[model samples]
Target: MDRTAAPGQSHTTPSTALAYLNPRYWDERFSEEEQYEWFKDYSHFRHLIHSHLTPNCSVLELGCGNSQMCEELHKDGATDLTCIDLSHVAVDNMQRRLLSRGLKDIKVLQADMLELPFGDECFDLVIEKGTMDVLFVDSGDPWNPKPETISKVMATLKGVHRVLKANGIFISITFGQPHFRRPIFNAPDFSWSVEWTTFGETFHYFVYVLKKGQRSSYEDIPVKRFEVPHVNLLHEELESEDFAFLINVDELNC
Candidate 1:
């Protein structure tokens, strides 16, 4: 939980790459049973999810961690709840808590998010909290170099696109520049759209409530033609990477 960046290091990296993959890391952090500081104060996340969640609808949580908010969703009448976490210990803890409380029918998966082991169009709602930042911070993950900051963000959105039913909802909270707002409405895999925003605390958090609606009928929408001015700087860096152009941005020239 080293929260501060190293001196002279403008970028922040995850303290543990694949650390959650290790059961001990999760077991230690969650065993304390105190609510994580971030979750305790953020009711906006819960409100956003509740707005999109329907009674008896299928839901999936990406990077659920040890958050108990899923139970809250269930209490609000969410049916067919499934959660994915990279940590076995975290999943085990969730399962045990559900069982102890006599809860039933929640499915949990312990797998890496970059490669979700699930069928297509399976969920009606996919929710995430601050996961994009986590992906960028995981510098040592072998999945790929610390994702081009925004590349992993787009990939996560793509994953949501694949697993969501037509008209399914994707509710995510993101922290970054205003430019990220532009893509949620135009990404080709699904028709992206906005829902809301809140300039709260230290983060300019945007609540992007995307629906897995029909992609434009035009199949010839070329990816090469999509360009932002600073994309050229990333040509050499991300050229060899599989997920290119997922995150190209100007560094604000500050």
Candidate 2:
């Protein structure tokens, strides 16, 4: 079988990368990995995350996985929170963990981010850590990705946009650079004002703060209508540079 990797991201080929989108993969992974946090853990950016959150704000975390982000948030005084993940194993493990810890206020549900199971204008803040990046892993030609790639990413963003209340914020923590991520984020359809701050010890990780209805950048792509896209990923390596390069090179710029 022939497999190909994007210029800089050789960690996984496009063909194999598809497995990263499967729920079963995560189910098995979370069972064995014991405890793993994608990108930096909550402590690394707690101040930054807290800046956008209030003690009483309603929070929704997409692709909760096995990360302790929600637990940390609850400990810090934010209790009105719900977490969702496509993998039943991850949801089940997280639920059990929360229960054993005596934290019942936080709700963990098995869900897909592409089609969030929540009402519109319900959450004050919707956030994802490395959730949206999964949509782009197998996305060919990051500069000019395939139609389906755009569709999947757009569909998930639309769901996020739909569920957020007026002036609500969507926080995304990713290895995606501004040049690669902003167009989709700033699209006219989302109508969200975008601001970003980078954090990391060696290579910078982007934290995009999209304020609902702010519309700072105007992107005029054909809007992908709201739909339930069933796709995802979980593999993340600190994002090294040996994978791609300076010319027309991408794949999350790994």
Candidate 3:
């Protein structure tokens, strides 16, 4: 796997996009790969995400694959942390890995992010690195994504929104441009301020900082209505591209 690839990057030519949405694929991969980082390693984003962390803050890491983020954070003194992933292989591997490293406070669980099995206002900070971008993996048309794609992203993000305490921070790092992602973060139902900091020089990556309480009017942004489109993009794209994260860099400036 090419770790240098951009966020929402298609893995390969063999319909790898759909596989990312499936847990069995990840289970098999994790059984073999054991360790991998979706985007840059923990050190790269530490400056961008670490500011939100505190030694006592309760943190939840969604879709925590083999990424060593939680472990590194624990080493940084953030002990109260929970990491969840759909891949049981990953959960087991992480459990053993952290234990061998003499870290015991971080809890790694096999759970779905779409339906976060937690009570309301439980976490101070929820973070995900290239996780939600998986929802857009099989999404058709970077411009007009399928309703199913939008629905998955919305439901999962809404779940994240629900588990956050008042003024809780959600740090999502991705290659999704502000125009494409800000609307979902600033959706009317979600009371949050969407502010993002950019990273990566060649292919820009975004660290979207969403505060739980502030609301944005979404002024000057074309918020695409999440209505059903007439065309069957899934039916159309399955024949051609294995994944669809291809967007013009010139068009997306932070």
Please identify model 1 stretches exceeding 4 Å from their true place: 1-28, 31-42, 138-151, 199-204, 214-254
Better of 1 and 2 by lDDT: 2
- Note the residue pairs that clash in candidate 3: none
lDDT of 2 by residue, 1-254 (tens): 00123233222222344556666667776665445566668888887788778769999999887778898888876789999999888888889989999999999998888888999899989988877777765676666787987998898999999999999999998867776677788776878888899877755678899899877423444434433322122223322231111112233322
Estimated TM-score per prediction? 0.66, 0.80, 0.82
Clashing pairs in 1: 14-137
Q: Which numbered prediction scores highest in TM-score against the true structure?
A: 3
CA lDDT, every prediction?
A: 0.57, 0.72, 0.74
Scored by lDDT, the top model is 3
lDDT of 1 by residue, 17-85 (tens): 334234565556655443332223245456656667777799988877666667777887786899888
In terms of lDDT, model 1 sits at 0.57
TM-score for model 1? Answer: 0.66
Report the Cα lDDT for candidate 3: 0.74
- Higher-TM-score candidate among 2 and 3? 3
Model 2 scores a C-alpha lDDT of: 0.72
